[model samples]
Target: MTPAAIIEPPAMMELHRVWKVYSVGPVKVPALSDVSFQVTKGEFVTLHGPSGAGKTTLLRLLYREEIPSEGEIQVLGLDLARARRGEVAALRRSIGVVFQDARLLPGRTVYENVAFVLRVLGTPRREITARVFEALRAVGLSARAQAYPAQLSQGEAQRAALARAIARKPLLLIADEPTGNLDEGMAAEVLDVIRDVWAGGTTVLVATHQKALARTLRRRTLTLQNGRLLKDEG
Candidate 1:
């Protein structure tokens, strides 16, 4: 099979009165209540909030990991609530997620880690090699391509995770607490890499609890509190 050479054309996301309620045995807890908003194609946005404020849940909804108990979610022009399994898989292929923990495969080399995505989608070996190196270079991890996850500093690990996400050249990139575990200098480095990705035209949504980070990025910020959108400061 050939590599995935598809270009991204500014992906837009929409949510209309979305609600997510989780039932824990006999008690039902609402994670997100009546949330609605839209992210225009190629726009960089941030979701800022304290823990338990529904930021992660909201993101998971976009990736369709958790379906809404009510309301509607449309991502990349598909209705998530009604999207079939195959559709969801295809959607995810075009979306990249950087979790707080980095989520790198411990045993896999940095290059292989990024290449895994392409290989899974049938990208040819030569294309995978070039794309993997390209992504590593983007995040300043080219020199450590052969390093294992355990050998990396927290910062390097995070950058490697970013490289893995970018290898696919996703249309939409979502990062949660990207710099949460890093120190001042390391956090700045990671943020810079993310900013570069946004500059390259991929729609980006970043979730972080750090107010200072949000202000520093200076992108549009959506504040979430108590499962509600408290503010939309663009």
Candidate 2:
């Protein structure tokens, strides 16, 4: 899709009465129940709740990593429940996801790790180099491009992961507990990067259990408890 096409979609993500349940020996465990929200382009939304509050499950549904047991989802204008496999893949290309773990490639250099995403999407080599550095610079990792994941500090590794995600210049960036494993100072640093990215016009949805972090963002926040949306405040 062209840049214009990507910009045309007003709602980057939407959920309508979505439910997700897991079956364990005739017992059904509801991970998410009747959750509904919309994240539009250029918005920074936060999803915060304690552990086991189904935060991860909700994000999985949005990214098409898992299917909801009931209800509908629209991501980048594609109906997730009905989208073909190729269509879903295409949708993911426009979305970026970060987890609590940096999840970097142990064998690859930081530069290569960031470039690998573009390579998979068939991005040109020239563009890949430019974008990789640009993303690294954005996350303040350009100087560590030659280092391996194991060689970096926890904060740096996460920043590298962030660089990889944003390198694609995705229309929507989803981070799940991005600062969960960081020290307070590091967490603040990482969040500042995220805020800067949002300032640059990329829509962001962050799922974290840290109430302080959510409050720091000062954006639209959705609270979940026992799989139910408890509050939505700005």
lDDT of each structure?
0.92, 0.92
Off by over 4 Å in 2: 1-9
lDDT of 2 by residue, 140-214 (tens): 998999999999989999999899999999888999999999999999889999999899899999999998998
Quality of model 2 by C-alpha lDDT: 0.92
Superposition TM-score, candidate 2 onto the true structure:
0.95
**Would you list the clashing residue pairs of candidate 2?**
none
Worst 10 residues of 2 by lDDT: 1-10
TM-score, candidate 1, is 0.94
Candidate 1, residues 126-218, lDDT tens digits: the string is 798889999999999999999999999999999999998988899999999999999999999999999999999899999999999999989
Q: Which ten residues in a row have the lowest lDDT in candidate 1?
A: 6-15
As for model 2, its CA RMSD to the true structure in angstroms is 4.6
TM-score of each predicted structure versus truth:
0.94, 0.95
